[model samples]
Target: MKRQHSHLTPHHPLSGAETTAAEIVSGVDLTGRRAVVTGGASGVGVETARALASAGAEVTLAVRDTGAGARTTEDITATTGNQGGRVAHLDLADQDSVAAFVSAWEGALHILVNNAGVMASPELRTPEGWELQFATNHLGHFALALGLGPALARDGGARVVAVSSSAHHRSGVVFEDIHFRRRAYEPWSADGQSKTANVLFAVEAAKRRAADGVTVNALMPGGIRTDLQRHVSDAELARLRARAAGGAELEWKTPEHAPDPEAAALLWQDSQDTLAAKG
Candidate 1:
């Protein structure tokens, strides 16, 4: 299938499952670059921050748990010997927290990693009545990126990485009932919809921000057991493990299957409207 964006080049030879983050960025210099990784206190977020810091980027961990963020900062600094590591509080589910973080940010931002997310959680909602997964995984990151647009565009060649998942193939955005107002809540379906939104956000943001030299993309970090799976039961975990052992191939959704330009635009507008209404 034809790709819609020029930036969607073929995968790099080094991007295989065995490739580590450190290896991907080996010998690369980011001496004066500034980066922020949401949920940088744990999981892949910690590793991402460490790798960026190792590359000499001034890294900030935007996390809800400042204590954990501080601990991660120290660990990264100790491991990388890069004193530029810092931590700031950010709760993606809270618009005010996102706004404050954006407002507090200074100067150009070379990289923003939308890495924090909840998975397969029980039914939950934000103050605005938005589903918890969608709110944090998509809309919160959406607002953060939008708010930081100027900072991101200040210097050419800024990058925004949205951590989506292969699970996006499970479901597309249900515009009619995104928050499950009428529809019954199902954990994985909500997660899939939100993950799809992450991709759509990248698609639309890339198109709109291309003129600003801001590159946006989504990635599926192949199944690693992380705290993100905290909500899964033992039975479900065992089933997933069995499936993985069976060598089940992950079929990613094609652009034709979902995340079309029209859908992207509609989602962007709807997200804007939703946030505005809440305000």
Candidate 2:
């Protein structure tokens, strides 16, 4: 498909310039931006929201719980001194909730981050009768985007950031087995397929949204300690932790040693720039 060459999708820009998150958004203002981040209450997602808000964006986090959600909002407000942060109830696996969110929301969206996903869990399904992983990870985002497409499109230059994984390289869309039908399933394979779909979702979305200034790009957030590993076994976690601490001689960045949220904030800034240019 890369050979088609019929259209242009944004590419990853060179990163040697050392523009950190805090730097890129330092003076930039997003005071009125209606930004929504799925899974923005924890880990890198929380960091992303903090950076955006620090830069003056009105950020909202879509999460699954109310207690933790309220606390996250309070913490972010305390940290950023910006109380625009709100917690919305949204389960990617539930299209009805997404519909509700879009209906209740009435405004142009500056940014939408499809960052919430399950890494590994016993196989599950949504109320819509779709597999839990692909349904929540891809189709849910897809539905949300489609539902919000018009509102976001009104601005003539909105952006969507689909947080993809390097695991995308591990598998393509298991088209036939998307729901794991006619085949026995392995948890990792499901995770791999979901990640690949994240990438392809951008590929497909950019192709369609490029002319309208809605740019979608996927990136590897390296590896951060998040609840994404709730399904990971204790043995697996210990082994990975050992390896992450120089025991595995791994070259990838880890949450502890990786650059801070300030480090990644610039990438999002450039992404906003790229989206504006594309339109």
Candidate 3:
């Protein structure tokens, strides 16, 4: 079978264009669409929710802090004139919370954006005994996407966007000793693994749900200073930049190699088992 590609080309109007989410969907109206943006309480997540709502989509800000979520939802509603903006509680680090959020979700979902993440934190493990970064950044979103599979499959179709990072280029999934049991726990390495998992999760989910009209994709939204870097010190940031500069030549990723079928399958199965074991 030949490879399928997106209609968007390098010469497309949005191609090579630095644009805001609101501007990108300017002409496209999403009047009846419903979207869920995790971590939509602040930073890029906030802007994303606002943009989608501005485009006439009913956007739910899934946040860990209900207080912040409510405030963000209010702000979004006030700015977009779309009263559909609402807030819901979601703590990705907790599987029970993820399940609860899914259970409370209603109606068809037009879009799901896995936008929450943590970066460069000191070695720590979640209550589930998994590495904190890997568990929250990757597995949590993995469960969220699958849990919402039915919702996403409804209402014609749905798009799932996994917000990965260029940091994935630094490392691939480390199946062996994934929790840093055998080796020393390095923050960046764990983060890279999580980001790579995000890409793989998107690829595999897209493949599995394509028959149901659900599309999944992953992207790196460039470097932006956000709450995600709360754990990193200024000195650490400088050191990170210096390390990146001295590393191998950076290569831009193309959609051509975005979905690695084999890796996708491995990740999918791994995620399923991991989640099941936790349950």
Assess each prediction's global lDDT (C-alpha) against the native.
Answer: 0.88, 0.71, 0.82
Candidate structures ordered by TM-score, highest first: 1, 3, 2
TM-score (C-alpha) between model 3 and the true structure: 0.89
Over the stretch 1-279, how does candidate 2's per-residue lDDT look in tens digits?
Answer: 221101112235445335555775777888888899888877778888888888888888988775677888888899889979888988888777877888887888889989999986788876545678877887778778878888778887788988877555444555445678777876776776677666666766776788888987776676667888889988977876677566453432222221222223322243234234433
What digit string (tens of lDDT, one per residue) describes model 3 on residues 1-279? Answer: 422211110112334437778777788899999999999998889998999999999999999998999989888889989999888999998999999999999889999999998887899888878999999999999899889989998876799999888777655777767789898998887887788888878777888889989888787776678889998888977876776577733442333344466777877887899899987
Clashing pairs in 3: none
lDDT: worst 10-residue window of model 2 = 1-10
The whole-model C-alpha lDDT of candidate 3 against the native structure comes to 0.82
Model 2 TM-score, all chains together: 0.79
- Each candidate's TM vs. the true structure? 0.92, 0.79, 0.89
Please report the candidate that would top TM-score against the real structure: 1
Off by over 4 Å in 2: 1-20, 238-279
Clashes in model 2: which pairs? 21-262, 21-265, 21-266, 243-248
- Steric overlap count per candidate: 0, 4, 0
Query: Which of candidates 1 and 2 reaches a greater lDDT?
Result: 1
